[model samples]
Target: MLRVLTVALVVTALVSPPAAGQPPRPQAVTSLLAGMTLEQKVGQLFVTYVNGQRADEEHPDNVRDFGVATPAEIVAKYRPGGVIYFDNDLHDNIDSPRQIAGLSRGLQRASKIPLAISTDQEMGLVTRIGPPVTQFPGNMALGAGRSTTDAEQAATITARELRALGVNQDFAPDADVNSNPANPVIGVRSYSGDPKLAAEFTAAQVRGYQQRFLTWSGVAATAKHFPGHGDTATDSHTSLPVVDRTVEQWREMDAPPFRAAIAAGVDSIMTAHILMPRIDPSGEPATLSKPVIDLLRGELGYDGVVITDALDMAGVRQKHPDARIPVLALKAGVDQLLMPPKLGEAITAVVDAVKSGELTERRIDQSVLRVLRMKFLRGILTSPPVDPDKADAAVGTPENLAAARTITDRTTTAVRNDGGVLPRRPKAALVTGWGENSTRTLAKLLGGKALPTGATPTPEQITGAVEAAGAADLVVVLTSGLSGSPEQQALVDRLVATGRPVVGVAVRNPYDVAYTSVPVWLATYSYGAGALESVAKVITGEIGPKGLLPVAVPGPTPYPLGHGLTW
Candidate 1:
């Protein structure tokens, strides 16, 4: 039985239709398009969430009935016009899920501009797309793709899944230049530390998502962590992360991929919450900076929508609580504000800023026009009302899973299998797995007793696992990182010296494999189960291996790029 199952994609050809060759912009924008006051345009600049539980406070009757995004009522009373998605689970079922999309449709029925809903769903692990759905590796995995083609496959598969789910905006393909290994929050989510490779793959991912243009009905692709999220040790979720890389370093390392993505016609750009005093010197996060947005909009020539990361994050609310971030973000030229249900409060803030001459109606209009443009391009502005019920058969179909597996097959690279560690033609083989998700996938694929080797392996544990495998004449190690910490490196070294043709799989960032000379080095690039199953197929000879290292596998020494085997 194949551990990796391919499911056909079920396209909801009806709900939200694509605007092919949409004549630049559709004249058929929503009737909501009909209600326009200059103040509403400025108000539409901020997109906040409505906590359903808070609905009762704003309208007591809302709880008794479907008031439509009750949490939004507090702010909707003010009328800021955009909405964003976070970790909120919109449904209880995976195959047939009833999502907040329904609620969103309900709210848009009342908004000024068609509300744009967004999520940080770069890959399956980063989202709540329901179960039995295939997930690809994160940006780290895509960066590890043996070639630009690999990244494209990963991107294409990812795009298909999101489109099927009725999500119009994906805050994916992290463009941040992550040179620092210690960087938290963005480790496996980034493409590469090398700007050139990152740029190439970023473009690849764009193509992947774009290929499904018709299927997505104009889904917006967002390349984020702009100005770079890598090189910072701090996580913005806890407090504001400060990037110390000077403007010069950013120009060379951090800016290329994002520039590439924008040029590729990405529909939107997301602002990072980090502060780089080097760039602004004023101590403001990129989401609230005139300089940052100006650089992205003016210098980069990104004319599409500009959105902020979740405003509810600690980085924005804690650091600059009283500053009116949503208002400043728009004045700074961001087209959409994310996740502030206190839409009324945010609108009042923006209204004050404009009245005080701190912001102009023109500035607000610039953003509103862009928001309208996207909805127009998406065929949602002037299109028919999308009944959420029409979406039932469209989410997570077999065809979509096949697309994901196809991408995994294309992207998963088998760099080395010297000594025939693979095609373990022998009756049985011992396999050791790694990471929470990957370990599970490998076990399912290999179909035998497998042991967990942890992130970094201990010499004793590795030796023990290898010895156990030696009994079967082959030892396969699937690892993202070595475990057993300070004393564990020696154990891995000993396992290699066994001359058992140990097969090693790196989950992402082939950097860790540089130090050891494991005869077989496979870089899968992510924690997705789909990638793991692909790797198992490579070893079991179910599929021929063709992936090469897209990035250098750094260790004490780095493996040259294009390092992989041909079947």
Candidate 2:
């Protein structure tokens, strides 16, 4: 039955809608677009970042940028269509569910049109909202489990929590195929290396996010970094990375998940910052390239809201100044300018472009209508405010956490189990690893001593861990990003030399197994609480490893994509 469903989905994805047959615009959206002024219409094209948890609180960044100290004032002055939240040390928009709910209600109160509140709640390493929001081991883990049902359930839980907090849109389900192991930005964020697998999981997640969960409406799902960011070695946040895949190669390797997303009727598609010179020789990144955007619209028939990936990033700003990026993105058929560096400059530039005949108000209307249609379709206009008092009851419930744990349990893959080293009880176990929290959790779960290593461990630390390994019958070393870290690999190698029956666990990227040789190798894909618990259960024979390899591990003896071992 699952095989039949998978085949049906892939078949549907391959068949694109005719170019001339577009979906009819909602009359409410049309009316809303007609009533809006030029400034308001231009404002609808932008989704900016603002600081503070409350709408009324004074923030330095808001004060300097918008000349407004509060979120409400900024919203009133700029009239942006949406707002995105980030949780960092300097400025945090997420604290607790009730706090976030209050912030969402306050923002809605200030806006004439309801705002599409969004965040990058992609759940593994890229998670923005923390506990008591249920954290699943991310997309790669879902791929490892090879269960479309689990994938949809994870997204369903994510959407439910976000809606309770009054966040209407989610920038998630990274559609990039992680074909390149050296990729810095999108490693485990991607579902699988195989295009078909990635497409299936991407489609399932899109459906999960858009489907109504319980009492709350669905949050808008975004299939991100189109056409694909999987094969790039560079991080677009710092600089522009170019993918050199020919048009045919891109169609086969990079375009499947995006096609699946469009077929599933994803609410939005976020453009990548990297340059695909093969597609558009003009050297513009996909975020600001007409040919690239046309491929999504003209070829894929994705007429939904097209958003840029953070215009403030160095990738988009490399060719043009900060002010010109919004206009170029709009000109390239991008509907929403996400996180522009200077919001005021971006708005002024768009307004000036319209007045100077560089861009038509109709062009602005085209994007605005799309954004308004999304808001209306997603029920953002009718139900903007959420109950702050009931948010705690909805988010991170025991049922949600249990579901997350079950999914993570299914994702623990035993890649190498030499001599049946796993599913055994060791007299004394030593837990030593790069992640402090993960190592500590594993140590506690195993009732063993933990010697945590930094991301880059010193010789003395390695020696100390080795010396500690001698006292235990079993040693488990947690590795992360080992493909690039020789020192961490050396640490694992040195532990194996101790003849202590070492087991290497990849808590981040599964590619760590390729960099080292260990008698027993297991991959959890994420070091989150649920994943850590799952790994512990697999090690102690409480549960067998049920996960398959989502991506191939290249080493002296390469493991194929579907490789997994069970007791």
What local distance difference test score does each model get? Answer: 0.64, 0.87
* Model 2 CA lDDT for position 23: 35
Candidate 2 structure quality by residue, lDDT tens digits, 111-217: 77778999998889799998999998799999999999999999988998899999999998899999999999999999999999999999999989988321246
**For residues 263-372, could you state the per-residue lDDT of candidate 1 as single tens digits?**
67777788888888978988888888888888888888888888888787877775555438787778677888876534456667877887888888767766776776
Q: What TM-score fits each model?
A: 0.80, 0.95
Those runs of model 1 whose alpha carbons end farther than 4 Å from true positions after fitting are 1-34, 37-39, 50-80, 87-95, 98-104, 110-112, 130-137, 140-164, 207-216, 246-248, 341-344, 387-392, 416-418, 453-471, 487-501, 517-519
Prediction 1 global C-alpha lDDT: 0.64
Which stretches of candidate 2 lie above 4 Å from their native place? Answer: 1-24, 212-216
